[model samples]
Target: MKHIVPVKWLLARLYESDVVIVDCRFQLGKPESGREAYEESHIPGAVYLDLEKDLSAPVGEHGGRHPLPDAAELTVKLGKVGISNDTRVVAYDDQGGAMASRLWWLLKYLGHENVFVMDGGFTAWKNAGCPVSAEQKVLIPARFVATVQHNLLVEVDEVRESLGTGRYVLVDSREAPRYRGEAEPIDRVAGHIPGARNLFWAEGRQADGTWKSAEEQRERFADAGLSQDDEIVVYCGSGVTATPNVLALGEAGFTRVKLYAGSWSDWISWQDNPIAVGDEEARNDG
Candidate 1:
């Protein structure tokens, strides 16, 4: 029922008729490797969803590298994968929960509240000696109705408009180097959006790969000077990695948070948008 479930929790419900486990393991560099790994060996009875093909829309001039897929199309895919309105979903990945959290965020945005991300991902399952199989699963399709929750997402225009207004707290979820414009392996622009503070998504997890406790998450955000009531807007390079931070904000007791689904890539797509390099300025101003 929680947003992040442990391997033991999933192992207990592995065979439940109402539960579906999703394999969201993806590599940004090798886009096909996640499917290859799923084909090679995955959690028993788990289904695979490609980040590029299934989770996101085709990239155009505007919607960033990984745009949100159409709601109708996404729910249709969910139906084919045996996810009905009431069916519970548990998503997992090897990439430290980024890919899995993307699915978790999508399901939530589609108004599916029963979805959850598996903590520590497939590696934790393997380390725990859980069963793994190479056989692919095919389940009876069911209707999945989507009620889109538009509040969970913030477009580039909204992000731009909120700058220097203090209406929303912009949190850049990229690594410190990328946030500081020191290194950029992806995206043409190196700097981050003006008036954005950096909070690397990886900090939400512990050294052992498990997510930190609620209290720990609170401490993490509090150290970043974020309060529970702040209207936080999170973003990453192409909107994939920011989901973890969004999830982390929820765990930290923040009820109001939104994801900048276009992220930096989309932000930079508009040449007129302002970008800030180095560290954040003393004030949150565009």
Candidate 2:
């Protein structure tokens, strides 16, 4: 049960006794908005995980906008929300797997193996004609153990070293415009990492806004010069959107992927850090 659960699977699991459904709907522009929508209406018995309050630490110049929360804090938060070792957790967000993938990554990082991302998120669920329940579900607290896997993440130095050696396939999950140094709406500088190939996470989504099948995802990875097994590192503006690619690659059967959690935004903000623009890219700094 390490893979993302399909819409049909989740619809049936809605009635499972120990299932934990978390609504992770969020907007990058207005962070508080996701919770409001959840409070208004959500999957019956679903609880909310706030991106800022529950999922991330406060933004700073050093850390990206939504830095990963402390493992201890997240364990407490998940427990307070009634998560436990045996819980079958299902998470979803509005942007297909955008925000939901974040929680998926977090849960995996914390060593929760059975967690699933609701394919297509809430929209897909509603489109499937599943019933929505607004009542907040009561929870009985249970112990959640978080054994953070340090290897799942990569720092900037690790990326820099992998560059000259060609030891890893660096990938930018941002759109081509942003990855091409053409249009950057959020961050200060508008370019991607040097030598990193483009694999926009949005491509992983279907026209209807749900993840494509695992076979389709595997093909996309192969098209990008990525095989089912490769030493690959993924990144987006920050660490958030990149998780979708992480999920996609994993779904595609690549188990060696790692995330540069402090991605472009974090890279550009540094004075002596490497910067690249246009089609030709790589490091200019020592």
lDDT of each: 0.92, 0.85
Provide the global lDDT of candidate 1 against the true structure. Answer: 0.92
* Runs off by more than 4 Å, candidate 2: 280-286
* Top candidate (lDDT): 1
Model 1 alpha-carbon miss at residue 14, Å: 0.8
RMSD of 2: 2.8
Error of 1 at 144 (Å): 0.4
Candidate 2 per-residue lDDT, tens place, 1-286, comes to 2468878898887878789999999998987799889988899989899877888877788656677788999999998888997888999888768888998889888988888898888888888888887788887788898888888988877887777687888989998889988999999888877788888999998898878888899899888778756789999987889999999888888899998887887787677777777764333332
Candidate 1 lDDT over residue span 94-171, tens digit each: 999999999999999999999899999999999999999999887789999999999999988888898889999999
Candidate 2: global Cα-lDDT?
A: 0.85
